[model samples]
Target: MTDGMTYRERARTAAHPTGRVASSPVVRHALGRAHGAVPDPVTVFDDETPAVANLDPELLRALRRAATDAADDGVEFFVNGGWRSPEYQEQLLRGAVSKYGSEEEAARWVATPETSAHVLGDAVDIGRLDARAWLSEHGARYGLCQIYRNEPWHYELRPDAVENGCPPMYPDPSHDPRMRR
Candidate 1:
């Protein structure tokens, strides 16, 4: 359906294919927007977008608490991805497969719908390097912790972390036990 082009290439073409008036709906759907995608400028506090509003309540609360403190230090938390629909997860997996040239390679980056924390509303991908750094240094106090060593932007709530500290991270999604499901 993508004419043998990778998803990124197709996205570029759909966004500006010589005289194209608008982006292709198919591309948008495949990317994220049509499946509970996070809106631009979204923060941990956002409750209007399904991406944020659909997050697990405890996770959202911890994120908000951490974000509020991070803000005082001039670091703002921005949501890059959260609470994805299964269709969106599959689309992303397909794109990853196309980009990485194999399912094994892609698994390091994107999890299958059945194994993805985003699908369960328990994971969030935060944007911006400074925000990630802020979280990296102080997140444990709020029960928020980076889940993967390779994905500094991806976080999850671990209530026990506030006292016991965050557990060791897996090298990547592929090494995560949950991803084996």
Candidate 2:
């Protein structure tokens, strides 16, 4: 099922329609870097800018809607990272390797591209880590889900959409250390 639009194309319409969001004007945009299954730290704006790293465009659409609603009620939020580069994933893998020892061990502890949530371009890294109450209360309305137990900051687009071949619901995480890198 093709969505007939590239990820960049879709992202433009939703978050960066005027391209200002991509710049540091309204939102501080970064090129979606990952570190240990989470987004790399914020590029800037420890406050006010609400980091949104590693956010897939389809997921961004859902998140943007939620952000709009939150803004109405005096809440502030933003997406940080979306699509991550292979290099970024390597940095994340390195972190795991350092924590677990050996590349194989790290692979077990972290996800590879074949099974990465980011591969779907439907997963996102949202911000306001200290305050998830608003999201917890109304995130479902936008079809976004906080699926990862280890990482509450991670959000994914509705899984049922076949456009990206993602399962309707998240698959269980593998804990077998033997299967990791």
- Every model: Cα RMSD to truth: 13.1, 10.1
Q: lDDT by residue for model 2 over 29-50, one digit each (tens)?
A: 3443232233334321122222
- lDDT (10s digit) by residue, model 1, range 1-181: 2257643333333333232323211211123456767657576654556777677767876777666556667777789998888998899999999999999999999999999999888999999999999999999998899999999999999989999999999999999999887
- Model 2 segments more than 4 A misplaced: 1-55, 102-109, 159-172, 175-181
TM-score of 2: 0.56
Please give the TM-score that candidate 1 achieves against the real structure.
0.80
lDDT values of the candidates? 0.77, 0.50
